[model samples]
Target chain A: MSSADFGALKHPFVLRALEPSDYRKGYLKLLEQLTKVGEISEEEFTARVEETRHLGDLHHAVVIEDVERLAIVASATLLVELKFIRKCGKAGHIEDVVVDSTVRGQHLGQRIVDHLTELAKQLGCYKVILDCTEANVPFYEKCGFGLKERQMARYFS
Target chain B: MSSADFGALKHPFVLRALEPSDYRKGYLKLLEQLTKVGEISEEEFTARVEETRHLGDLHHAVVIEDVERLAIVASATLLVELKFIRKCGKAGHIEDVVVDSTVRGQHLGQRIVDHLTELAKQLGCYKVILDCTEANVPFYEKCGFGLKERQMARYFS
Candidate 1:
């Protein structure tokens, strides 16, 4: 569905690319419900958003904003990586997906993921991939993603 | 280790970022050693390289080049995603890692992965992650990556 089609969401909720003004909209606060979100000032938030904007259409940090409440209720980022393989095919990586704790049962997470997955296809990606904890496998499956491989990480202090 | 430290490798082998001129150096041909690489003209290759170049250091497509042969023998990309969490922290995702089949025993894959892992740390990434097939588990483990979660994928035609 196109951005114009988001009217299907409840009156107050709309999904769109993250904006600089989201700092005041509790964007970071909503993310804290998913993982550690250290204090981020408005300046830093806007600067980072500008840096991502320089990446052109390659970075999509989609968010579901509650317009009536002036707050972000859910978010996820779809990162497109250009590749030399598959004849320069693009690969889509969905990262940091989260739904505000208060909006748990609303299915906002699935809506945002499906939207990004479709965006990936529209961008000519050969595949869209994501890594998730065991508990979240069923959720992603419901969104049309199938288990593919194992995710390995090395943390840096 | 810094780029200069790559001298530890056998003579003529060095790891570095993907250069525009790499198109003439068999970079795309090298990737075909790992996966399907459809016909890509030199013009297209250089154009894509230029586009990726615009991303600055956020996209690092490192390669192990055989200077003597003027060919890219191994290659991988380290994509850094800016995050609002952890006070604007960054996360790194490694993709399309491959070592030429002809030079498999020289440990080029390990060397390249190690270099990118170190690069990610130097760039202040909270974690470096990758999705790999089961057969490659032992390989990445030797490079200091441990299984963290499952990778899910949805392919688009």
Candidate 2:
């Protein structure tokens, strides 16, 4: 479908505050996308999704959906995590920014990022950070993120 | 001096729990190392150190010393942060895992990681995470970490 066609695909693409009902569907979608990218194993993804859903009450998620049926197209979460660096004030970490591959080249990702950035600022974060692969550096840079000297580790054992 | 000679230099290295008196010096040491690595600008470093010292009260730091003086060989912090997913749980992020260059090749880094891992377990975290550059991947792997997925992002004006 053309960009305009997809844009008019009846998805309610508005940004809204995260809700509790969004957890199960959003977490499953995130797990599917992350597993597709080799980020987590099926088993770990299942466990992690369950764990994350439990944490749903603690954080916020924003979703884009189809207006009529309200099917989710993309989603991202803003986590209010404490920072040891007091100068950071309270920090917000953006996690699980995902858009369906069918619409990859479209501007959905950027829209979600913009929404989260504004949300972080409104939440009074001194800084907002999201970690991505080396390939995605330019994408985040365009979103006003400078390169941070941070790395990620996952524990399965 | 060579690594062996440096080890034999007999500087007073004290290993103790973080104390109110230790905040200023410890914060400066952290800022110095971060600045040396260019992770933060000098101005940003100064401001952040002051801020972290206040926040450090919520976390813990272990300092090393030689004889009668603190040497600041290594430190680890337990930062309370949120992780978003379907099964949300309390998370602890480990940061500022540092060991003096003079003490490289020693097991101090591993010791710090082990200590913090235990602390995370005690803090009731479902998981503990930290990010490092490619260069430090092997070190973290050796310390019992596996790879997670790479993050992707795009920015919009």
| B1-157 per-residue lDDT for model 1 (tens digits) | 2342445677789877788899888888888777899999988888888878777668888888898999889999988888778899999889989888888988889998988898888888999999999999999999999999999999987
Evaluated with DockQ, which candidate comes out highest?
Answer: 1
* Lowest-sum lDDT 10-residue window in model 1 chain B: B1-10
Q: Write the per-residue lDDT of candidate 2 for residues B1-157, one digit (tens) a residue.
A: 0011113223454455544444445544653554333233456655544544544322555545444544466666656554444234445667667776777787777767766666666655666777677788888888876665443322222
lDDT at position B21, candidate 1: 90
Q: What is each predicted model's overall lDDT from 0 to 1?
A: 0.87, 0.57
Across all candidates, the chain A TM-score values are 0.94, 0.69
State the DockQ of every prediction: 0.86, 0.19
Residue B111's lDDT within candidate 2 is 66
Q: Which candidate is the best by TM-score?
A: 1
Q: For each candidate, give the TM-score of chain B.
A: 0.92, 0.64
lDDT of 2: 0.57
Native-to-model Cα distance after best TM-score fit, residue A26 in candidate 2, in Å: 5.7
Shift of residue A54 alpha carbon in model 2, Å: 14
